[model samples]
Target: MQPDPRTNLNNELAQLLNNRIVEPDYKREITITFRVSSAEKTRLEQRCSGVVQSDYIRARLFDYPLPHPKLVIPEVNRQAIYELKKIGNNLNQQTRAINEAVKIGSQPLSSNVKEYLQTIKELAVLLEQTHASLSQPISDEE
Candidate 1:
């Protein structure tokens, strides 16, 4: 007995689809292929402007330009932390200045002080999180 057309279509649909693995190349040329309907392609293009069918297809298929990591020596991070600590005192002083300026109705000075204080707060939070992550102790429950 021959299988029904709908049954054959279901069997084909069940076939495993895997990506074509390739070597890592940030700027290397690549190709992509998909069996998308014309309507689907048009919808995608309309939603994301300046994206031609070919460009979208190529982007999906190939490795595109990716930035290389900036070289950061371990010592650089240490120096940065040290500098951050030194600047932390200045940030505190600026925060105080902001309060004084606000009292004097110096809106511009107050704004600058608020900006500096916010930056300092962000830096402090980041430093605290980094230190905590690095110095996590083993739990007694282990």
Candidate 2:
């Protein structure tokens, strides 16, 4: 009696993840094979972007460029951050001058300016709390 086609396919679908120990170039040669349930294989197929599974495995096992798209981390905009810091410094200096003039009775401190100063003080409290929280190690018991 011959094996049914679906049964043969089920056999093909079984995972073959066992490995033989060998010298490391991460591979004995540039071939890798694995089998799994059809659903898992379908999901894995998406990751390889239609490249032959063994070849995709080889590309990943060694450090070769992938035929498929790779993950990209966004770069930090250092120049923009530096400009922001400069603007913040300028605002701080202006705020200090306004406070100094008000203290010496040379400037009339309006309600809006007082509200801005209150907001700045609250932001400073929040900044201090954030800094202290970050400065502590995560494993400490206190």
Candidate 3:
């Protein structure tokens, strides 16, 4: 028996980590149709990896290059990123409140401003490290 189309699609998609051309094409007005199981369609969407569905289909069908498939993000890293963003937002709010206070002369501008800036820099470095670590799973290393 012939191999399943889904399996073949997966195999073909494994090599899709190259960049596509940047020119516009007018011949893409033609349409193609095919049937896929619901689960297979989900798989296709997953493999599309943030690209437009039609673009993904055309690349697959025409044997063109595509970006690295952005599959599942790491669970731990995802949570950490969320928590860090929350903390950053809260910090920013507090800093803005302090700035407003200083602007209104209700509070004196302290030398600790330098210290707060240093803390923000540290937080930025930490977030960047986390971002790089989280990106490791989905980023194309090839």
Candidate 4:
């Protein structure tokens, strides 16, 4: 007599929020695994009195219109200037870092560099695949 994992998790979350506890409806155990960052785990444990796991995700769905603050940025020549300034600032930071590393005689192409390049290449390939998949006309199965 084992409860489904989904049912057990839902019940546990309900109990936690209600400041109560309940054993799983079924006596048998089930194992479920997922990943969570340590910071998120700590935050949940601090806020909740009962079991919390990676499977639980909080979502906010708006079925009704909710008033939100509007940010109006008037488009003008200054807007483009600000964007270019931000980009220039970021590029400057990268340039400084690279120059400093070179001054220290760090290896131009270390294993870490190769691994990073490989990761970028893989990401580009993934992007191309994703683009191709999206470009193909989707057929609905009857």
- RMSD values, in order shown: 18.7, 16.4, 12.4, 20.9
Cα lDDT tens digits, model 2, 1-142, are 9889998776666533233222336535555456699998888788786467665765766545567444322233334445445655666787798899999999889998898888866665665564444444333254
The runs of at least 3 residues in candidate 4 whose Cα sits more than 4 Å from the true structure, single-residue gaps closed, are 1-107, 140-142
Local accuracy by lDDT, each model: 0.61, 0.63, 0.74, 0.52
TM-score of 1: 0.29
lDDT of 4 at 132: 48
Q: How close is candidate 2 to the true structure, as a TM-score?
A: 0.32
Model 3, runs deviating above 4 Å? 1-33, 36-54, 62-64, 138-142
After superposition, the stretches of candidate 1 with alpha carbons farther than 4 Å from their true spots are 1-80, 108-116, 131-142
Error of 2 at 123 (Å): 0.7
Best by lDDT: 3
Candidate 3 per-residue C-alpha lDDT over 50-102 given as tens digits, one digit per residue, 9 for 90 to 100: 78788787677656576555456778878887887787787677778877888
Q: Tens-digit lDDT track for model 1 on 17-96?
A: 34343455567576756687999977876643444556454455554333322333356566665666677667677668
| Model 2 local distance difference test score | 0.63
- Cα deviation of 37, candidate 1, in Å: 84
Most accurate candidate by TM-score: 3
Q: What TM-score does candidate 3 reach? A: 0.52
Q: Which ten residues in a row have the lowest lDDT in candidate 4?
A: 55-64
